[model samples]
Target: MEKIISHAISERVEFVLIAGDIYDKEDQSIKAQVQFYKEMKRLEEARIDVFLIHGNHDFLEQERDRLELPKNVHTFSSDVSCVPWQSPTGTKIHFYGFSYDKRHIRENRLGDYRKHGDADFHIALLHGSEETKASEHDVYAPFGLKEMKQKGFDYWALGHIHKREILSSQPGIYYPGNIQGRSKKETGAKGGTIVELSEMGATFSFFETAPVMWEKKQIVLEGKADRTEIYRATDELFQTYRDTLCSYVIDLEIVTEQASKFDADEWLQLFEEMRTESPFVWINTLRFIEKNQAVSDKWYQGQFLADELDASLAELMEDETFF
Candidate 1:
């Protein structure tokens, strides 16, 4: 976060926009608040403004302010609100946002946003996941992508979806994702979005901010591929890119057919060897995948039970080491 703020300061960005979910918990400790403010104060000193909306997990209580913020930090109200900011270059930007008052918001808050300013660029800061007709997900501000697209906002900066995704490009709708990944489930490139606005509109791109990366790499070999080849390839690939990744736990699953020479002991040994050489590489799982190719075979069509037994024994026989 300090590095990110320093980067913004060096770039002399007009303003910083945080859609929501500043903290993992709403009852953030004083130390955490101090650390967060310490970074924000730097931007405040640099004459750069910041706009933030508190997400469901980071809502303010009815109690008096829990943390004090600098003059430059402007947070949106619990109700939908808009703030018009005039850039140093005399460009007007209308920013619409709202902080979550509760942990779960079932209502579609998009209707609450009333576009009021004649600013050159109009943008919305939303913190919710897109809802589908058949989706079983918790309805947090239930809304559809199509409705959001037709809302007339020039750009939509979204949050709540921890994985970065761009729903649209023309009138940009983006989820910057969480800056830091907390778990293995949240893997891959974790970072924030950088939006550059002009007469053409907002051009958005994602930049890596997490010091450590969380990634899942799946490695599958062909039916006739050598076991040694798999070990060598996995070793070389990790060794080649290990330095670039701060830390990673790769979940590896192997898929093979009758031609495969399988060895659980050998694979486990290789995993150990890699960990000894590169401690950052943690192999989570080694799975054997069974494809439906056997069931589709003409020879196995009418003999389901017989074919199942043969296929299972074939796989076992291929892995047998004892005489």
Candidate 2:
């Protein structure tokens, strides 16, 4: 994160926009604050401003009011508010947002941010879950993508869902995701977006900032005739992926009925010993797949309802793309 912030110095961007969730906790540690202060100080020295809001994870109630922020750092109010920034080129950009007052915000706060300003770029800054049946989120600041797109804003800077996606490009609604992958679940290139404006409208692009990445890889051990062959095949599998571009925190899944043959402790020990053999692979998980564990066709023959559910579960679990 510090490295990326330092990189901003050379980018010559007018300002940095962080939608929300800068810290994991509202009451962030002194070490984190000090580090942030130093980074912001550097940004200020480069004449780069930073505009940000607080997400539910770092709600307003948990803010440290005593710590003085850098002059270049601008924070939004707890209530919905709009701040307009005029570039030296006379282009006006209005940023609208509010921080979470409580831990869970169930209300649809989009109503508060009705884009009424006339500016070269009107961007809505939001930090919450999008309304979709497929999502398992706790419905924080629930909002629909359709309504957001209809608001006539030039862009939507969204947060909380740490998976960079541009849901729409017509008006440019973007989620930059998180700058750092704090856990294995966030597995991919982690970074922010760079948007350029011209007569052609806004052109968006992404940059890589994460020092380390989390990735999942599965090695099939079914064809290995015995434990010795299985061990050899696994080593070959690692060798094949040893050329992975970046340093990786890997969750390795070994798929085969041979899982029962090896002791977990010994397998992990072997993995640890050879982990450094690959330049980039670090085994964060060593899971053994127990192949053919699903119930047989005979078990589902008599019970129709049970068979239907069992079939669905099997499809969900066995489908290679489910994850």
Estimate every model's Cα lDDT from 0 to 1: 0.75, 0.75
Best by TM-score: 2
TM-score of model 1 relative to the true fold?
Answer: 0.78
lDDT tens digits, residue span 1-323, model 1: 88678878887888888888888876788888899999889999999999999887787678846778998999998888889889899989899988888877877888987778598888888888787553444456767888887888888888887878888876888888888877766788777667886656667766777865666665556655676767776787577665664656666665556433576566767786767443367676666553344335445556658777775554344211121
Provide the TM-score for each candidate, comma-separated: 0.78, 0.83
Count of backbone clashes for each model? 0, 0
> To one decimal, what is the Cα RMSD in angstroms of model 1 from the true structure?
9.2
RMSD of each: 9.2, 5.4
- List runs of model 2 lying over 4 Å from the truth: 62-66, 134-138, 198-201, 240-245, 277-280, 294-323
lDDT of 2 at 58: 76
